[model samples]
Target: MNRVLRAALFALVVAYLIAPLLVVAGVSLNERQVLFFPPQGLSLRWYGAAFTDPSWYRPAINSLLVATFAALIAVSIALPLSYVVWRYRVRYAKAVMAMGLAPFALPPVITALGALALWIVLQSYGRPYTVVLSHGAFLTTLPLATLTVGLQNLNPQLVEAARTMGATGSAVFRTIVFPFVRPYLIAGFVFAFVLSLNEYIIAYMTVGFTFETLPVKIFASLRYGYSPVMAAISVLFFAFAVVVFAAVGRLGDLPRLLGADETD
Candidate 1:
């Protein structure tokens, strides 16, 4: 009886979570230009427009570029930070890591405001690269966390053995540390990339006028009127996230990468 009740509760929770997405999916299939659920008629024209139309396509390309570079920057910062904290055990490393995590810890609106002020002070507001850099800085915590977990799970004996065999610092990392942490590194990149792809406020604040990402563009379109294309884009993004996470799980020991301990 207890197991049956638990299963029923789980199904209810899943349905509650998925209900909104299902509504959006239905709206995206509407034949009319206006947003309406339980469509007047069913069609996929909005999805086609999202791909072929320059307005939609361009912002999507911009989002892809920003997300790619932002993920790279995040991983670059996290890799060294995690390595230094783990290997050297520097006294200030924890403080530095905390600083790295501050952006994510704070409300996103706060981070967006800060990024806005930063670009304005530098007189670099509206530049295309500003969004990428701001996003990279804000999203650093994800990769930092994943990499830290990977390093914690690493066996110190391996590093000691490599050093005793006369391996240089670079050699030791390349042969031992990096291999152990590579999965975590990839997971971290994926986390940062997907979040960056969907991020809105920072992109809008940093480069709203000059460079538009997909999310920014979607909001920009709202002033004119609601379009089913926005719904279509939302569904497409949801699909993308689902596919990326599924791939990560399929290709890796996802639970272990995410810090789950090995179970016999």
Candidate 2:
């Protein structure tokens, strides 16, 4: 009876969480321009528009580019920071790690505002690259945390053996450390990429009207009034998120990457 009750509660919770997305998906199927539920009739035209329409397509491409570059930048920053802290136990490592995480710890608006100010001061505001930099800095924490976890799970004996075999520091890292943590690296990159793709505040604040990510574009489209295209885009994004996460789960121990124990 207890197990049945728990299952029932779980189903209810899932339904509550997914209800809005289901509604959006249903609305995306509407043939009319108006946002309507039960969708007057089934149509995939909006989906086609989401991909082919310049307004949606261009911003989406920009978002992908920014996300890719931002994820790379985040991983570049996190890999060394995590490695030094884990491998060398550097002094003030915790403080340094905290700093890496500070951007994410603060409110997004605060970070966005700060990025805006900095860019303006440097007279670099409204540049396309500014959003990329802002997102990379803001999303560094994901990779930092994931890499740290991977480093923690690494066997010290493996390093020692490599060193005993006359492996140089770079060689050890290249051959062993990297391979061991590669999955975590990929996980971190994906985490940052997905978040960056969906991010609006920092991108908007940094580039304003000069650059538009998909999230920024979606919000911008709202000013013109409602359209089924937005709903179609939402469904596309949802499908994308599902596919990416599913791939990540298959490629890595998703639970452990999320801080679950090996035993769990």
Candidate 3:
């Protein structure tokens, strides 16, 4: 009875989370040109429209570019930074990390305004590359934390064993430390990529229509009016997100990175 009750509760929670996606997907396939779940009659017109429209495809490409580049830069920086902090236990590392996490602690609107102000002062407004860097700055905190957790989880004796074998610092990290933290390194990259992909406020304020992205386009579309095409785009967004997450989990223990004790 307890197992059944637990399972029932889990199902309810999952359903609550997934219900909106299901509705969007259902409406995307609706034969009628309006949003409806269970969707009148099924059709594929909107899916075709999602692919062929320039407005849809352009922003899709831009988002892909931004998310890819932002994740790469953020993770590359975080891996080394995380290692340095963990290895040296530097006097000011905690203060530095606290500052890195400040953007996340504040409301996103505040961060968006900050990014806008930064771009303006630097004369980089409306540039996609600047937006990418801005996102990297904003989202670095998570990957840093993930790397820290990964490093902390490593058995200290392993490092000592490598050192006793006359291994140099780089060699010790390359052979001993990296393998243990590999999962979290990958996990951090995945988290950074997904968050950057879905994020809107910074992109909206910093770049706007100049280098429009999928989220920005979605906001524009919804601002104008909702349609079956928007539903189709939403469904595609759901699909891409699912793919990113599934592929990443194949490379690492996602739940563990997310604070789960169990590796599985």
Candidate 4:
């Protein structure tokens, strides 16, 4: 009876989470000009329209570019920091990591507000890179987590063994530490990229009209009207996320990187 109840609950939760996306995807195929839930009839016209529209295409391209850069930046910063935290037990490392994670932990409005203020102070408000860095900083939490988990799972005896053989810290890392943590680094990068791809508040607040990302564009379109093209854009974003997860799943034990206990 308990097992049956658990399966039922799981099904309920999954349905709750997935029903909205399925609705949007269904609506994207609507044949009528109006956005409707039942989707008057099935058609692929909006998918073509979404791809052909410059407003949609331009923002999506910008989002992809910025997210790619943000992921790179986040992983580069998080890998070393997480390694030092895990390997050396560096003083105040937790505090420092906490600071780095603050942007993600705080309300999005607060982080967006802060990034906006910093850009204003530096007079760099209009640059696309501002959004990249903001997303990078905000996403540091992901790589930091996965890398820390990866480092924790590494054998300390391996480090000792390498040191006993005269391996320098840098040598030990490159040869021993990096090989183990590389998958987590990549997982973190994928996480950062996907998060940045979907982000809007900081992107909108920092660059305003100077740069636009897909989320911002969709939001603007909603301000005036709604269309099946927006649904198509959403479905495309959903498909991209699915592909990213499929790739990440192939790259590593996705559950372990997410802090699941491998011992289990």
Assess every candidate by TM-score. 0.96, 0.96, 0.92, 0.96
Q: In angstroms, give how far residue 33 of model 3 lies from its true place.
A: 2.7
Task: State each model's C-alpha RMSD to the native.
Answer: 1.3, 1.4, 1.9, 1.4
Q: What is the per-residue lDDT of model 2 for residues 1-264, given as tens digits with 9 covering 90 to 100?
A: 699999999999999988999999999999888788888989999999988999889999999999999999999999999998888867898788898989867988999999999999999999999999989988999999999889989999999999999999999999999999999999999999999999999999998678778888889878867889999999888899999999999877899998887854
Minimal lDDT window, size 10, model 4: 81-90
Off by over 4 Å in 1: none
Candidate number of the best lDDT: 1
lDDT of each residue in 68-174, candidate 3, tens digit only: 89988888778878787788878887677777668778999999999999989999999889889988988888788888888877888889888998999999988
- Full-model lDDT for every candidate: 0.92, 0.91, 0.85, 0.89
Which stretch of 10 consecutive residues in model 3 shows the poorest summed lDDT? 255-264
Pairwise lDDT winner, candidates 1 and 3: 1
TM-score of 3: 0.92
Candidate 4 per-residue C-alpha lDDT over 177-262 given as tens digits, one digit per residue, 9 for 90 to 100 = 99988998888888899999999899999986689898998898899888899999899988989998998888678888888988
> How accurate locally is residue 139 in candidate 3, as Cα lDDT from 0 to 100?
84
Report the Cα lDDT for candidate 1: 0.92
Question: Which has the higher TM-score value, candidate number 3 or candidate number 4?
Answer: 4
